[model samples]
Each structure stands twice: as structure tokens, then as C-alpha cells.
Target chain A: MDFKKKQTEANLKPGDRTVPERKIPVPHRDISERAQEMIAAPYNVFIDWNLNPPTKDDWSKIVTKVSESSAPAVNKLIEDLGLTVEQLQIGGVKCYRLTPENIPENHRKQLVIVAHGGAYVYAPGIGSVREAAMFAAFGGYTTISVDYSLSYENPFPGAIEDMIDVWRAILTEYDPRSVAMTGTSAGGGLIMATILKIKELGLGMPAAIAPSSPWADLTETGDSYKTNEWLDNILVSYSGYLGLAAKLYANGNDLSHPLLSPINGNLEGFPPTILTSGTRDLFLSNTVRSHRKLRRARVPAQLHIYEGISHSQLSFDPDLPETREAYGEIAAFFDQYLIW
Target chain B: MDFKKKQTEANLKPGDRTVPERKIPVPHRDISERAQEMIAAPYNVFIDWNLNPPTKDDWSKIVTKVSESSAPAVNKLIEDLGLTVEQLQIGGVKCYRLTPENIPENHRKQLVIVAHGGAYVYAPGIGSVREAAMFAAFGGYTTISVDYSLSYENPFPGAIEDMIDVWRAILTEYDPRSVAMTGTSAGGGLIMATILKIKELGLGMPAAIAPSSPWADLTETGDSYKTNEWLDNILVSYSGYLGLAAKLYANGNDLSHPLLSPINGNLEGFPPTILTSGTRDLFLSNTVRSHRKLRRARVPAQLHIYEGISHSQLSFDPDLPETREAYGEIAAFFDQYLIW
Candidate 1:
């Protein structure tokens, strides 16, 4: 049955017009459309969707199973594709590179890595990778974009292992203090996960990390999930999320585990962090919860929530004023923490 | 005649010398003996020797003449005296009541008002009615303490102003945020002179202010005066400040003129401020210039200097945990701004 029929059967009472039925809004429909575009855009090819084509009866279960399976598949795909190394390496893993030819010499010494978002189901896509490169070139930093394994094929350990390899390779060459990591959406989730992993391995932390509209909690405990269901311009409904990608990524593991859901992670000893999100982003709750957790942990975290921007807005158009401001703030934050 | 020759004659040199040329730090002297007893023991009156009496050279010709005529004969005999006012009226111009019971509820509001140091002859005296009451009880606000006037009547604004009127009244109120204002030496010059007076005429800004090692420029421009003079502890050297205070608070008009000296009249719109000073208490240069100007301008100001603290030690007091962690950080700053 559709969600509406299920709700009606579960909650409806005969002759109870007084009890209003929850109705999905138009904005949610619009967001779903945008999400589809974001997922299907040409730049997304680098990320293996690892989707388990739609099935009948228990739609939710099917999607969850697929998401879990996709994780390892994403890992195998990365290997089978023979993704080329692009010069820059950290901790012995190949990190994609943006050339110094585009960036000024003074700024080239700096590096900014942009991690892609897919709730751990996808790799860094071309658009996000290019955006990272553009930001590095304009802001005077060498940029690396990582394309990690997704959930459907490889599941839990697949993405984590690939990311660690990439980080180790990069750390081998660059001073940890000179590096800055930033990401949006699922990409944001990975950036944080990467930090936690690096810290565990006794590696030096990056100078700073900026996670925009991060999905820190896969458990969906944030108030915004319910309050902003239809109000947000993007990720309006958790149906697609809780039903599909989240389930796939969990791969039968407890979704609340810190490694799987970093919002619950022990954030002590983390470097200064900056979080940015918009009121209209579906993941607003995730961003706020993460920021509050960081603050309570005394992690020197700063959160700047834009009034009305959507998820991934910063990378979508760097020409926009808000995007520039966000980027500038990130740069300034780096200037304070990361001395050349 | 110059400080250099006097220092040489006194046989004072830098670096852990047992006996310094200046009597301020007499070898084997209990530096805090009197202060400790005053702070520890309950006493109605307290006094300390070498409290760095203002020098005659600090007064301008006109101020010197006024001092000669207005000097109280009994002041020379008494080291220090403490009194509570039932109501002290000055020249029938401004009236203030001293009774703890009579102080209005609003006037009783907790607040600490520190007197500016300018070796007296400059800022308003304890007896000056408006300086104490208006700042303390006016506009439904309560303030306590006034540094008693000091100097050539015994030079410039004296220590009496700081000890008696300002500090005494302020002690009645003890709320930390309510308590504000400080001064360096020279009664710490006028901490409120800069922003308060202007604010009183409708330009008051800032709820609190801090002037560190001020230079309430009595001589106008003593940026680096007597740079090569005696080994000065509290100031760059004493010659610069001595010449300046003497030039500014020369006569009756000079002492009262808002521009020349603030000690004599009209201290309105002053906020709570803090000032810092040190054992060296290098006469005028350290406290007079920046602090007096703030008080004259009617800004709320305070000064808190360490006994052995050098000039501007508050800013560099990370070694002293209290000083470092409690320095006026953004949280304290927000306390003032957030209310408005």
C-alpha cells in the first residue's frame, strides 16, 4: 500500500473528520524532483549508485537490502574501474588532483579536499570534484576530490577502507596542518567519518573541516526531520532516505553506531570545526545536532546557518554571493588555524 | 636632575638586584604588608607608604598655583581617613547621600565603579557630588567606589579620590557584571573620560570599558618621552608623564577643563570600566594619558593592575590562569551587548 493508505488504515477512525490526516506538501514533490536531478546529473557518474532496481510488496525492505549490498559493490567498482591516480597522495592512497597550473604559486601550497555525498552509497562525482578544484584554484589551494566506494555493493567497511587509504596517501606528502576538508550532504558525513578514522590511526588532523548540511545522524533523531518535512527545498522527505539509501548503507549494522552515524561519535580531541547549513535544507536537524554535540564536547565548533539556502547550494554555484561568503569564511577559518 | 643620574646615584640596575634605586621596591621590604593587612583584616582606615605620590613637576603652572591656594592644610598631616556620608553636598551644586538605608533601590543595584588615576589635580574629587552619585544611582543604576583625589595638594588627581569616594561606595555593590570600570596609575587616569562624557551629552557607548596601561596624555604627546631615562618599572619613564600632567592641570581652569583635565567637573554618562597597574606604578606615563581621556569622555572604565604586574600584563596574563581564562572574552562582551 502507498504511504497514505497505510497511514489511513493505521490512524483513521470512522466519522472522525476532526482528526486531520497528515498530507505530503507540494514542496516535497519539488524536492524529490531536484533530488532526482542531483542524482542523475552527468557529473554523478563517478559514484556508483548501486541501486537495487525497484521491486514489489515490501518496498522499504527491498531498498534497505539494496543499499547494504551497494556498499561493497561500490568498492569493487572502484577497483574494477581502475580509477587513475592523479599525482597527489595522502597516507599512500591516490587522491585526485587539481593542477597548480590553474592555481597561483602562492596558493598552490594549500590543499582542499572535497568529499562527495551519497549517504555512503556513492563516490565523489565530477561536478563536486570540479567545484572542489575551482575553489582550490580560486582560493589558492591544491584540490583533491575523492571517489570512495558506495553502500550497495561494498557495504560498511568498503567506503571506510578506501577513504583511509586515500587519507594515508595524502598525509604522506602534505603537512596535516595545511590541509582543509569540506563536503556537503552525504559527502559531509564522510568528511567527518574521515576525521574520526584519521584520529584513530594516530594521524594528524586537518587544520580545519567545514561540513555543509552534513548528515551526521542516520538515525533521524533531529527535530527538523519531522518539523521541516515539507518546508525544506531539498531532502524534503525521509521516505526516500529511511526507505532507500540509509537502509542500503546500514547493511544490517546498527544505524546508530558512531562509525555508521557519526552524530553519536565521540567528538573529543577533534580540531576546530565549522558547520554551515540552511534553514531550508532537509538535513538542518543533522547540522544543528552535530554542532551542538561538538560545542558540548568543547571542540571549538562554529555553526552558521543561512536563512534559506538548500543543500549543496554552495558547490552548485560558487558565483552566488552566499556561496562566496561561505567559501570566504572557510578560507578565513583556515587562515587562522592553518599557517603556511 | 634627570631620572638617569638619580637612578645611577641610587645604584639601581636591571635584573634581580636586591636593592633598587627607587624606594618603591625597597629590598627586603614587605611589599604587600599593609595591603595584605588591609585586605585580610577589618579596618576602617588603611595606608601604604611610597604609594607613588604625584610629583610637583606633573602639574602645569596654573594647576600648581591652584594647588598652592586650595591645598588643605590637614591633608598633609593625615596619611589616610575613611568616612561614610549621610549626605555630602558639594558647593550646594551636587548632593549625595551616604546612608546604606537611604540609597535608592535602583542606586543599590550592584555595580563596581573604579576611579581613574591621574594623580588627582585632574579628575573630579570624592567630594565632587555628581561624579559619584550620578554614575552610581542615576538612570536607575547603582555604582560604588571613587578613587580619592591625590597629588600636589598633595600633585594632580591624588590617591585619596581613588581610595575614599570611588572605591568605598563601589564596594557596596558586588555583582560582577554590575561592577565595571578600572584605571591604571594616576588614579588610573579617567577610565570613563573617553566615552562617558560624550555619552552623557547623549553619546554614551559601551556598558564597560578597560584601559590597560593608559597614557591619559597630560602633556598631549608623550608617545615615547624620555625613552632613555631611568629604568622604569611601571612606565617607560617618569619624566614624560611628570611634564605632561604639570602642563595640563596647571591652573584652576586647566584642572576643570574637560579637554585638559577631567578631575574638576562634570563626569556624566560614564559606564563601568577597568584599569590595570603594577608595583612600579611608573607615575604619569602608564596611567594618565589613555585612562584620563576615557573618563573625561565619560566612558565606563576600570583598571586592574598586578602589584608586580608590569604594564598591560592583563593581556599577557596567560601564565596566571585567572587572568587568561577570565580576561574580558566574548562571553563577557556579549553580557553588555546582549542585554541591549
Candidate 2:
């Protein structure tokens, strides 16, 4: 922890230097105790992934396991929030429609499209509905959770195409000005990519988008990859499964292609955006860079960074004050921008 | 940097665990070479002070040495930016007035006050003019840099009182609506504190303020204090001179006093504000928390965080793209809020 010592020239490239290993305890700061416990817990998804990538069957099995384990909690969340969920296929893309028991009058006609985060590989089916449940519960709006093609079966243009189809289909029933998008991690990145495509294909733009800890940069780019490498509890480093997942999803496409790394996209004419990330999230830079890109293009943008959080952990518990505040911010933003 | 392994129970507090020492190369992501070179260099101000705080005389000598060392570059910056510096006394507080050539027609009647940062102990005289010069050059407004009493010579209320005096005197000649304020690090904290005092005294508020890498929380009450401890490079940790400086500044007063730690202050009436920091900045959380507090109070606030840079290193070199962009953001914020 002594930062006074200077490293000697060890023949390492500037980008090749490693941050030393040290124990980072949960900071006793202004964050909630629940957040502290999450930080104190072991880093999430710390699997000893081998050199070879997981086969599609392996990924499918993993996804199924994760989905089964998460289903009970998602069901509880749906029931606790007085929401109803129905599986449907819109334009051949699988989706979940979550409707709250009591929608606010102002939000009765508003719609929020949800994209779930799973590294573009894991978390399918019921596992993808947790965020939708929280959005429905907190924002008091009907939500549609998009279940796009995972990289294990399909690759880059596949998820994008599926989301485009969903967006196109959703627009027929709801006013584009009443539609907004929300997602976390890979799902967050997908929403940004979907917006870019929406703008490019001449589809009407949504009112706003909230991308939480968006994995907007597919490559191991950005300072947080190095600074928050091991510090982040989830998605600890790009060298692990995150990098593999990025490669699988890119499917030989340049990772920097605006669609793969939406942070590099032309964000002009994009809708108002509110991004959320934690200080310890590995994609902290992705969220930060995405915010900067939006601001540079004169888009109205707001950013919320939670203390001691890693990845999309804020979405883990809707009862947490941080989660409530985040959803409140997004809802308020929607209220300001979404046409009645 | 494998995070797969959990730490063994080593009888360390969650806050006492040290981040392992590793070489952190300048990220090859989206930062300028100058910033990379800074991150690649030895940590700034890495002193070998013994296990005792410096005496006032020793502190004065240290400040003078730093000021002398920084003088040449500060002078060069003033000349290159075509700014004129004048010494003056307003309300018995020593100050530097920086006037830019070719002030914009809309900004001819506006004024900006600058507070220099040195952990509240250093950066006196010409050393304090760099930020003021940058503001004048980038913002095209006449700026007055307040040279408050150093904490070594005078503590908490000293800097606050001096700033309040400067504010009162400046307001006599300039409309509060046409004036703005900015500072870096300790100076940033001072501006926030002074504004709190200004409001308490029923003085009108400025149009906007930009505080870059503000040390707003004196009690090490944020995640960055621990997560960015050594990685920050500047103000390496609170246990070092930063802690000592905080103690000296607070004297016997409580560290969490709203005037000392403005992040906890009632920020309801704060003017439109913009905050800037970097991912590696030790005060990143301070900036984040301040923005959160301001937003919670319904104040319009924006945050800009550069990649890889630490502390207020953005103000170290005027020619760096990051520095130019930071100043541009501040200038634009001022233009949007300051009355014409």
C-alpha cells in the first residue's frame, strides 16, 4: 500500500503493467450497510475459467442453472411488487411483459423496454425478469423485458437485429415519445446499440434511456479495466470470462465498431440518457465514456455512481436506498421527457 | 491480478486491508500522452516526513519551496495564455486578479473568483495563479484568485472567513448573477464552504460554480479514500500528509462540520454547478457525493471525469487536450448560467 516506491524499468509496456494485489476492505463511508455487505462478500462470478472457451452446450447448461436458481427470487419480486408477467414473442424475438397492479395515471400510456444483463452469454428466461420487475415496481409503468439471442448460439448482429425487431414491433402500439429503454451491463450496451440502430434505420427515437454500468466498450479499453481490475467484485477483469464473452459476442467483428462498442457510436440525436455505475464496477469507464460521448454530442445526460458497488449490483436488491434513488432518477427523467 | 482467490482471514478490518502493490501503467485508452506520462512518473509529492506533523515554520518553508519550484511554469502559462496578473487586497484579503485579452462581449461584465489548492497549506502567491490563468484563458472572464490564510498559520474558519470577505467585496462591484467561482482540490472545498457561509449570511449566490477534484469531505468519508489510496498518485492516502493537512485545517473543530465538509451541508440553494474529477482521483467520491447532494437538493449539476488522471493534474498543463476539454466544459457551464 506504500505508493512512495517507484517501479523500476522492468521491460514492460506502459499498458502491460499490473496493479499490485492488496486487500480492499469495504469502506466505512456513507453507503448503506447492505452495500457494505455486498462489497465484503467474495467477488461474484469468480470462476476459474480455463483457457478454452465454454462450448455452446456448456453455456446453455450454465444459463439454465442460473435461471433456475434466480427464478424463486424473481417470482417473489414480481409478487411483492404486484406485477404480472407473461411470456410473449414479438416479431419472433422472445420477451416478457411485466404489468404493475396499479400504474400511475401519468405513466398509464408510457412504456419501458428492459434488456437484461448476462455478459451476452448467461442469464436467459426468468433470470432476465428481475430488472424488469424492479423497474415496474419503482417506476410504476408497464415493462417489456427483451430476451435477445445470446452469443453462445448467435453473435453480433444477431442480438442487435433481435432488439431492432422488438423496437420496430413495440412502436406500432405505443408512441415512441412514450417509450423508454432501461438495462444493465450487456443489456445496457444493447439499449445504446439499439438506439443507434433506431436512429440509423429512421425509426422514431425513444424518450429516454437508462443504461446502468453499461459494457459499452467491448475491448479491454478504459482506465477502470486497470484501476478497478481486481477491486471490482463482479466482472473482476477483462482477461477473465468478460474478455471471452466480448470475443464470442463480437464474432470476428471489430470490437470498436460502434455497434459492438456503443461508446464509439455517433450519439448525436440520441434521446436523453441517465447512466448508473459504481466506483468499483469494471465497466465504470464504459459508463463514464458513454456519458461523455452523449454530452459531447449535446445530448442531455446524467450519471449516478454508487459507492463500493461492483458491476450491476445495484439492481440486485430494489429495497436498497441506492436502487430506489436510481429508479427515482430514471423515472423523474422519463416524466420530464416522455410525452403523455 | 487474478481476483478468483479470496483473501485468507488475516485479522484485518474491512477498512484496513491494503490493495496489493502492482505496477499501473498509463492506460492506453482515451487519455493524452501528457496525462499518461504523469501516471507513469513517480507519485507526486512523495515525501518522507517522519512520524510527526510539520511545524508551522517547516510548513511555511515547504510551501515556499513548492511555490518557487512551480513559479516558472505558472509564469509561462500566464504569458502563453495572454493573461495579465495583478496583486490586490480586497476586504483585507490578498488576491491576484487575472484579466484575459479579448474578453467575449457577453462576458465583459462578468467576474470569476479562483481559489488555489495545496491541501490548504501550499500553493501561495504566483503558484496560485495557474488555475486563475486557465479560467481566464479558457473562460474569457476576469478572474480574482483568493489567497486565503494557510492552515498552518490559521485553521478552519481562516480560509472560510477570507473567502467570505472576498465574496462580499467582489459582489459590491459585480452582480452576483454575472459572477461565477471555481477552484481545484482544497480550493474547491473552500468555494463550497464559502458558498455555504455566503448563504447563511444572506448574501446572494453566484450564477454557477465549478469545483474540480474537490476535497470536500475532510474526514476520509468516501470510497475513493480507500479504493484509490495509492492508485491516486497525488494525496496518496489520508494517513499521510493529507490527513495531517486535514487535522491542521480543522484544528480542534469537528471534521464533519458542514462548513468543513460541505458534502454534508444543506445544499438546497446552491447555484448550478459542474464538477470534474478523474477515475484515479482520490477525491472522485467526494466529487460524486457532492454532485449527489446537490442533485438531491434539486440543483442542476453536471460531473465530468477524465480517464487515468489523478487529483487536479488536469490543471498542471494547459496544452493537454484533457486540460483544454476540462476548461471548455467549465467555461461552457459558466456561459450557460452566468447572466449576460
Find the candidate with the highest DockQ and give its number: 2
Q: Which stretches of candidate 2 lie over 4 Å from their true place?
A: A1-20, A45-53, B1-3, B6-19, B45-53
| Model 1: DockQ vs. true structure | 0.01
What are the per-residue Cα lDDT tens digits for candidate 2 across B1-340? 3333433222123433345456565776666787787776544443332224458788888778878988998999999999988999998999999999889999999999999998888888888899999889888989999989998888889999999888889888989999999999999999999889999999989999999989899998888887877676656667768888888889989999999998878999999999999888889999988887787799998888877777888877888888888898899889999998
Q: Model 1, A1-340: lDDT tens per residue? A: 8542332333223211111122211211112334333322321122222233353234445434544555454434333433322645455444566554444544546677878665665433343354465456446666787766557566776667777787677777888888888888877887887778887888888888888888887875654454333334345446444446776777788887877778878888777887876534567657766765675577777655443344565555434555666676677667777757
**Distance (Å) between predicted and true CA of B113, model 1?**
14
TM-score of each: 0.44, 0.93
- Model 1: per-residue lDDT, tens digit, B161-226? 233333333334344334445443433345534333434435324356554455443443321222
DockQ of 2: 0.46
DockQ of each: 0.01, 0.46
* TM-score for candidate 1 (chain B): 0.32
